[model samples]
Target: MCSFGLKAALLGGVFGLAALPAAAQQTKVTSQGITPTEIVLGTHQDLSGPIKSWGVPVTNGMKLAVEEINAAGGINGRKLKLIVEDVGYDPKRAVLASQKLVEKDKIFAMVGPLGSPTVLAAQDILLEAGVPQLFPVTSAEFTYKMDPKNPQERLKFNNVPPYTDSVRAGARHLIQEKGLKKPCVLYQDDEFGKNVLDGFTQALADTKLTAAATTSYKRGASDFSSQVAKLKSDGCDFVVLGTVVRETVGVMAEGKKLGFSPVYFGSTATNVVEVPALGKELTEGFYAVGGMEIPYRDTAKGKAKEWAETYFKTYNMEPNTQSALGYNDIMTFAHYAKLAGKDLTGQKFLAAMESGDVFQDMFGSPPVKFSPTQHLSATVFLLQQIKDGRWVVLKRDLTN
Candidate 1:
């Protein structure tokens, strides 16, 4: 889980579901109804908070998928009923929002809940409710560790590969393929940063290469001149960053000012629209790995392309990969929900997801697949670099 400050954000209002015996069934508001009229599903997102940049567009993408599905005669003659609540990227807000969705809205499943911290806060709630949270937006490790023996009792039905996987792939490419002997890391001092560092360290276990220096920063800090100066003095040739847009640009600019430009690498969160637009030259040649596919209108396929084209034509703005990721997540859930058919229970929904079928969606390079044991799908990531004015894929697909 590479979320920056989601845990502390849940201080006041966050509430865990009441602990009950394993045999206890979640109180369903109404009887199971999967007919020709409606199939209700719920989601939580950050519409107005630190991560709104990723949340708003993703919600739009989910809406688009629901609209398209409804238009195409619905799923098994039943229209999808989606209920979304704003979590504001706060774990407390996420808990409250999810509670409303589960207790009041009576949704069958949950989709997004963007931040890793937020998703973690709702884990017990969803599990206690016996509702399958399909394709949560965050990649936190605890989000997928469902070993009951381990007292922590984390769930493992996440859709995307863990953030550790992305970091491992990128770090291997940097050390083995790119041959950077003196690598450093500019990481936010949080769970997200630690996750990336764990992967990077694990990848460099056999090799002699070590992180020459490590710098930690807060999320909203504006200046990084001293940190970059320290990196320059450390003689680090490459730096892997674990931060978001504002901080990422600030550090790179500081590096340039200190006359110490290294091959900058970062987490998937760097794929923000403001980076290239505002940072300009500072963002060039920076690399990151992401679960989303490139947003080229021409190369897209089937309903995916059609959705992109229609979105562009209607809004007159280019959609980023986040939209596609959101679209794919919701669509994939709907596909399984449809496959679940009349027996619309949480176990049935989970079974449908783990049916060992590779589904081609508008999200990642490789299609998504699940097995009885494997809960995570879409293991492949695309390594992209900012070239010219846009992000171009450096490699087609790097399966972790």
Candidate 2:
């Protein structure tokens, strides 16, 4: 009887030893940027550059989100902190800023870093360090596309629909629904512009249509005379703008000057209040594709209205589409952070996001979903037109 009992005890000990590896595998792994009391994230923006029009408001939106989250007892008892640096819309400065954030500040992840060139410049360094690049502002396709040759490229995620997809939707609408032909494109000579051009080209191909003309301009060029003149000469009935706020205005203003009043359609880059404010009456009748509904102060309802009111109270200014975008991205991050559990790591945070959860922002538009292969959330867009110095919803959610 004593021998049998000892054998049983030995068997139980063996079973417990055999379970160790599995338990270890289930244990959470942690790394830098997470402390007992906080999680640190970083971003670089064009604080004093040509795009400061967007950078300042986006940063302000992020700050407000962080403030609200921290005030409400933080995320799982760990407060959130963001470290922002200015890259002045320069890729070299972006690299330097990212190096400081990763090597010196030791940020766990980068959230809402502005500009396609800036993100492309710094992505490799951050990904190599096993840091997640989360929700960069630009909709450049490379920001989220996984390289077939390298599976290690899974650390980057984009919250906005790719410029390709946004343009495709708009192009389909213009060609099929509006029955307009003679499409032309005016794009910047960079990744951001390239993505939009790709989308426009693809859409034309898909619909058995062809471009009347395509023109490119250097980044930060205030004058778009030659490009606009080319589109005018091409007799394009509709012009797709691969431009941001100022550039969009510049191109359209140039077109207006030339009496070239083609129906202008722009990607999400031009979907900002500043466009209308800067371009004034000239921006009127322009169309843009956006992933989320713009919360117009006069017509916003329910949660959007409340958010706008609070934002106005907090920032003492009106919130635009960019502001809402910045706010939504941070809030989405917070949501995934909660799902990542208390022992949060960059990998865990990413896993939480890729777990196929549907996320709906303050606006009652479509939900954003992510998976291993799909990183860009908010795949659909609503077509909006500027009327009476404001964006008026022209069409509901559109997908290509």
Off by over 4 Å in 1: 1-36, 150-156, 272-274, 298-303
Model 1 C-alpha lDDT per residue in residues 1-400, reported as the tens digit of each score? 1122222222111222223224221323222334448878788888888678778878888888899899998876778888889888778888998888878887777776687778878877876666666677777676665553432232246766577788778777867777888888877766667777776676666456777988887654677877888789999988888777778888988887778888888777776555787789889988888767667677777766787798777657667766777788778877666665554555455445555545677544467766544567757777888888688888757755
Ten consecutive residues with minimal summed lDDT in candidate 1?
9-18
Return the lDDT, model 1, position 330.
Answer: 75
**Residue 223 CA displacement from its true place in model 1, Å:** 3.4
Each model's number of backbone clashes?
A: 2, 0
- Report the CA-based lDDT of candidate 1 relative to the real structure: 0.71
lDDT of 2 by residue, 1-400 (tens): 2445434433443343344344322322226889988889898999999899889888988988999899998888988899999999999999999999999998887889999988999988887777788899999888888774554466778888789998998887878887888999999899999999999999898888899999998999999988888999989998899998899989888888899998899998898899999999989999999877778777899989998988888888898877887788788888878766677776566666666656788877678777655778767788999999988888887887
